[model samples]
Target: MKFAPSVGVKFHEDGSVRRFPGNTFICHVDPSLDLINELAWAQEQLKAMKCGFKFSYLPIESMHMTVFEGVCDQIRLAEKWTSNLALDVPLSETTDYFAKAVSNLGAHQGFEMVYDYVHNCQIGGSAIRIKPANEETKQALAHCREELRKATGISMPDFDDYHFHITLSYRVIELEEHEKAELKATTDRIAERISQSFGILKHRAVEFCTFDDMFEFKPMLTLA
Candidate 1:
């Protein structure tokens, strides 16, 4: 949508927030029509299921694949890292690699990186858990992570955990057991089909984002 420029927090040497940035890209996700379509489909399904859920579908503007967040200073370092990274890699590919690398890095390492790079910086977001996948899936994720490390000169800690969600929906209203089961079944089927389709596609990119709250996004950055 709209990209804004704003100053973020300034950090001290110890990685603490000197000040919070008033403007920042709080969420960064792929901005692709295909992803929009997928989300639209998922939303329709979610609505039709009518499991008494009160949460609204996240708008595209609010969704993002986070790069980093925190007090002003830490984010500056991450921004520098990202800018330097942009020089050596394509935006689409870099976004994909970041997602896949974090996923492949496992939960512990993934959490650490998120904490160190994004979370610790005061970037507000949730760290996902990797789901169980076959050997091929694991290998693919590992390869992506390795490539990111080599390119960024950032070594993630020992995190051998995986999560299978893309941080799509949240702030869910309470649901009954029956509703939960029904919704789970429907979402599971959708996830399975998506996983299969993505598995067949050798390369994919994280190019768009959606969010529960739109106002949180600030100082948006674009690749082109």
Candidate 2:
């Protein structure tokens, strides 16, 4: 079995998370029990796949949809990082600085996110795709992101083509053609069940969080 070289970019062969520190604004999935339970169930099913692929499932408590990405140690480009702050600024300091900079941005009145599909990222990960449920929700989400970009002074690379998603896991090994077929079949079933049962994910507050790795996001402050 040949492993994908890209898998080693973010994780060890044993599936341990590499150190990738950063901060961001996210809508956490933990506050809603129904949402959490549904996601946890889907995650378990993905873990149970017998196909010969290896991936690391993140802690359910850490599940979230990022509202606006913040500075990261790994990505030091001007387009992705905030201007006026050194690229080597401590993650904690950047988190603090952003908290105050956008403190007056006001709270989101909550929005409904409709299930889209399950996405298999080419870079070796799987995520549940989602979108705003209506035009109001759509505008709200976009406005928030735009406001954050202006307030934080960080221009996103994919600003125009950003897609909302809640990540499930990072693949640890490459999947063969046959394995991809099997994985897609299982994920399709899971996505169908989730869309039917819990189609709309009600996102309440936006949060500013710092993270030392992919598995955990430490909430520093709530934007809403």
Candidate 3:
């Protein structure tokens, strides 16, 4: 459950989730170079197959490893939520401690790990899935999500029931007859080398962002 081939997010279902004002704010890590190169290569392959429009490739900078999304806005509600959810700690002091502890976890200590194995699989009706090396990465990611859930009271599906994908591109259309044939041919061509490895995730800071402001990773904390 920590990582599965699919999470059944049901993005196409009409009432799966509401379109709230602004975007879902979540903490995330900046996309690593491995991701960028993999995306660039994927885009190249997709274009070579003459199916560029079938999928929307993520611009390199837009890629991120989501920690958790759809949480309360950091600026407006973080203080209240953290205060109420702080485990065994005073409301006033818990938030500060939480920030530093997470920020400091990186390659130096070992928690800032790498996704060395990668592959492609279809997910949530989308074509061409890109995922991490294994479940260790997914488990680590889920641990982060669980901690955030504990502090914010944000709801999440069971960790075992979650789908962990690492790519930023998503298929925008269903394959037509010819498209399916070409896609299958293309998949076969890339099948041998589809697996890739992204390097260690050395996060500089966690960001809370809305859809309106997708270009910037707005820092949710003031380290100074």
Could you tally the backbone clashes for each prediction?
A: 36, 0, 2
Model 2 clashing-pair count: 0
- Sliding window of 10 residues with minimal summed lDDT for model 2: 1-10
What is the Cα-based lDDT of residue 167 in candidate 3? Answer: 50
Off by over 4 Å in 1: 1-27, 69-165, 199-216, 220-224
**Model 2 over residues 1-224: C-alpha lDDT tens digits?**
55555445556777788888888898888555587888888888888888624878889988999888888877778788898588877767778889899899999658788888889887767888899999999999889999998889898889878999999888888887887887898789888888887667888689888888888998888876
Q: The CA-based lDDT of model 1 is what?
A: 0.37
For each candidate in turn, the TM-score is 0.41, 0.92, 0.53
Q: Find the 10 residues in a row with the least total lDDT in model 1.
A: 112-121
Error of 3 at 206 (Å): 3.9
List per-candidate RMSD values in Å. Answer: 13.0, 1.9, 9.0
Maximum-TM-score candidate: 2
Pairs clashing within candidate 3: 1-160, 117-133
Q: How far off is residue 105 in model 1, in Å?
A: 20
Pick by lDDT: 1 or 2, better one: 2
Q: How do the residues 46-72 of candidate 1 rate in per-residue lDDT, one tens digit apiece?
A: 667765243334455554433322112
Task: Summarize candidate 3's per-residue lDDT along 1-224 as a digit string, tens digits.
Answer: 12122212211222122222232323344455454565566557766766545554445566554555533332345433344444344433433445544453432111244543333344422223334345775565656666555545545444346444445344544556687677667655554454434445544434544443323344444211
